[model samples]
Target chain A: MEIFSNLADGFAVALTAQHLLLALLGCFLGTLMGALPGLGPANGVAILIPIAFTLGLGPVASLILLTSVYYGAMYGGRISSILLNIPGDEPAMMTCLDGHPMALHGKAGEALAISGIASFIGSFFATWGLVLIAPQLVKVALLFGPAEYFALFTMAFATLGGVTASNQAKSAFAAALGLGIAMIGSDSQTGSERFTFGHIHLYDGIDFLIAIVGLFAISEVLIFIEHHQGGAAAKSSAKIGKLIPDFCIFKRSIGTLVRSTIIGFLSGVLPGAGASLGSFLSYSVEKNTLDRENKTFGKGDPRGVIAPECGNNAAAGGALVPMLSLGVPGSGTTAVLLAVLLQLNITPGPLLFRNNPDIVWGLIAALFIANFMLLALNLPMVGLFTRVLLIPTRILMPVVAMISFVGIYGLTGSTFDVMLMVGFGFGGWLLRKLGVPLVPVILGILLGNEMEVNLRRALQISDGDWSIMVGSPLAIGIWAIAIAGFVLPIFFGKKVKNQMHADHSEVEMEEVIEGGD
Target chain B: MSDRIFGFFGLALSAFYFWATSIIPDSFMIDVVGPRAFPYIVGTVLAICALYILLRPDAEPDWPNLMNFIEIVFATAVMFLYAWTLSKVGFVIATVFATSYLTWRLGSKPLGSLITGIATSAGIYVVFHLILGLSLAKGPLGF
Candidate 1:
């Protein structure tokens, strides 16, 4: 009765004409931005946040708009991955393994249909899971103190294997580098400046948006330029014929769809394990199980496409649980979401549910509506979505660059931030060239300050006793998981590596590899 | 090898960071762990990673050829120049020049590239300044 009553109240707020329109717009823009090769949901949300802020949409409506973009981007990412062999974002990388092959075989329509259906199913189930589990999770999260929070953060860092480049050491280095970057501003606890170098701007710290734009958007521009030789245009012959699947394809992939949704949702709930990881894990599990002997995974198998597409959408839904319930963002896009919430002076955590039921339930209800909106937008408009790929890289890249400049400049209103963005752009390009992964760096920067703050808080509470780091069973369990997270990758690294290699080779000759960088 | 170069660079970065950490002014009221301790641990970890990278390189580094390397350097310079001049010249002028130059360098026709630069600058300026009600940098013309 409580859940039903809450759902009714949520619908009362979410189903308003104004809220419905915002959700629709968010979904449409999310898909468009997510379909862009270099700029994914993070960019989509980041660029739009300032606009939303300026629009003065109340907190709920703006969130509805932004979250729809997040969901829309996940669905949109599959379009490029399936049709052009270019993943729109990292999670979509796995979708390319089989999705493109299906496209190449002239079954692009079926592939898109199957993926669309799978995304709907995954997100549908995951949203229900969120509705059921988040309240309980928040209750548990309420029991967490600084010591337990420190342990949880450690667990989060330990599970950061999916973001690694070649080896664990490289990933660790990238993370540490990010942590060091996060330490640039004045210390929150001690009130002493850490690494400001006497500049007044440094006191507030490196803006996350500046770092994100530089690392993702500008570095992408630099890479695009470096690789762009004259007369090399993006060529794709994949056409959308029909947007519906027959019963046979549906029946065969039903199990995979269900299994992958569960895997993806669970993975998304983990602190730092994002949608990409969920996609990778689901694909691997399906590949290792259903097609074990001969491994028909990357050879245009519909299940291959279904598994990751479903998993990633589910994971996107799953990722929202932590951010809503505990105030800990599970991924980059969620981090941006958290930033927006903080900017609005709305602290997202357990207390938020009791204090602000309207916002919380409205968000939950809006997500349900957004899923259907995305399905409607994606299915009927498959042909229109494919048209976005025809835009040339030269034209697309410059637009993205200008947008990055304007977005950052608009947010901070400081040209110094623009320059800082350019500097980070160069740094990002160089780091990518040297084979260092950027995700860990971003995560490190995002979480570093929070981790230190919690750690210091725990230590101070215990009067310098280090044992407080694992003082409770929850802390002990988290540390144990963290250790396991560190160890499991070593044992199963080779299998995952081989599967990734297989995915890379299945496409038509690798022309210009861009995603998963 | 590129790894070695990166490894050494990482080492240098760690050393500089450690030195920087040493100079952070300690608060009079000492806590369990000072502000400098986290950076020191990070520096140490970074140094170890760097040392490992230097000692045992993973993959053979693929350095870009002469032309590509030159293009990269030139591009970096253009970006830096754009950043330096943005506030002084304002958004429209800086964006037009940087984007047009980059577009041209990417092999667009000169005239088309210039048009693109002007179009992009004008389009963004209108959206941010007029539509969004946000103030971009005011140059001499103030538009």
Candidate 2:
């Protein structure tokens, strides 16, 4: 009854004219942005955060708009994957395996319809799961003390190491660098500036917006220059023939869609396992189970197209569970959303349900609305999205750069932040060239403050004794999970590496997509 | 740079970070693990990872050629200049010049790039200023 009333109240808030308009705009822009060759959902959301803040949409409206963009990007990503043989982001790599072949076979319309339907079903199920499970999850999350929180953060980093980056040492170094960067502003506990180097702008500890713009947008521009000058790749001329999949086809794939959604959602709820992992895992599972004879697994099998699309979109919804309930983002885009929340001074956690139910539940309702909007919007607009690719890189890149600059400056009203953004862009490019993952760096910066605060709080409660961190059973359990997270990666590193090598482009796609956010 | 050189650089950065952490004086207000502790712990762990990377560096990936490197450097310098001049020259003027030059470099004709630059500048100004009620920097022209 409480959930029902809360949801009804949420619907009241989300269904408002202003919120609905922003949600539509976000969805439209997100699909357009995500359909771009290199821009991922993270980049789309990160670039727009400053706009959200500057527009003064209030917290709930801003969140509704941004989360809509996040969902919109997931829907948009498959368009390019199926048509152009280019995955819009890492998760869409699975879609490309069969989506392109289906396109080549002149079943582009069927593929698009099936994937759209799958994405819809996936997000629909996952959203319901979020509404049902998040309250229960929050109840458990509320019991966590400072020690448990710290341990959970540590576990997040460990899991991130396993799933995101191949080189554990490099990931650790990147995370440490982010933590070091976060420590620059005046200490929260004390008033001492640790590493400002006497610069006034450093007082606020590097505006995260600046870092995000510099890291993702600027680095992306540099890469854009490299590729654009080399002469752009040929645009796809694939034509859509039909508007919907056959009834028989849809009936045959219902079970696959449901199973993949479950897998994707479960993977998403687990910290650090992202949409890509979920999509790939679902694809593999479907291949083994449904296509035991391997008839049409990757050869334009409609199930192949449907399975991963469902998993990835579902995983997007799933990723919100940890972020909304635990304040721990499960993926790069979610991390950006978390940053947006923190910027709005809305700390996500169990308290969020009690204090800011409008923002939380409004966002949930927006997700439901956004998914439906995307499904409606994507079906007839396949040609429209394809036309987005026709915009020359020259025109598009400059607009992207200008928006980033204006957006960053508009938020801070500071040129130094802009300059810092440039510096970070250079650093991001250098890091990318060196094969260091940027997501972990961003995650480290995002989590560093909370991690330190919790650790100190735990120590403070224990009278400066660190043993209190492991004294509780919950803390002990989390620590064990963290330990397993750390060591199990090492043991399975070789197998993971070999699998990655088998699909090297997936790794490259991950690297490229990092710059989008 | 090769992985070996990168590893050495990482080692050097970690050492400097450790030195930097050492200089953060202990805080008096909060006694139980003050601000320095977190930085110290991060510094120590970073140093260990730096050493590990230094000792066991992976094979190097392919580096871009000098032309591509120069393009990247030039693009970065252009952005830095745009940032410097954004306030002084104001948003429209700075963005027009910067964006036009970027578009030109990326393969647009000079006239087309200029049109793109002007159109984008006008569009951004209209959206951010006129509609959104967020005032961007205005030069003497005062849009």
Where model 2 places Cα greater than 4 Å from the true spot, the runs are A229-237, A497-517, B26-28
Cα deviation of A11, candidate 2, in Å: 0.4
Per-residue alpha-carbon lDDT of candidate 2 for residues A1-517, written as tens digits (9 for 90 to 100) = 8998899888988999999999999999888877887789999998999988988889989998899899999988998888877788878888987887788788988898889889999999999999999999999999999999999988887777555356788877888888888888888888777887788878778777788878888888888886654233235555888877887987887889888999999988987688988898888888889988967766789999889999999899999999989998877888899999999998889999989898888889989999889988888887888778767778888888889888888898888888899899899988888888787788888888889999999999999998998989999998898777767766776686567445546534643664477
- Clash pairs (backbone) in predicted model 2: A42-A517, A43-A516, A43-A517
Off by over 4 Å in 1: A54-58, A163-165, A229-238, A271-273, A284-301, A345-347, A507-517, B27-30
DockQ for all models: 0.62, 0.70
Candidate 2 global CA lDDT score: 0.84
Interface Cα RMSD for candidate 1? 1.9
The number of the candidate with the highest lDDT is 2
Q: Give me the candidate number with maximum DockQ.
A: 2
For residues B95-114, write the lDDT of model 2, one tens digit per residue.
88998988988988899889
What digit string (tens of lDDT, one per residue) describes model 1 on residues B15-65? 999999999998766688889877888899899989888888878756677
lDDT of 1 at B129: 78
* List of chain B TM-scores, one per candidate: 0.91, 0.89
Check candidate 1 and list the clashing pairs: none
Clash count of each predicted structure: 0, 3
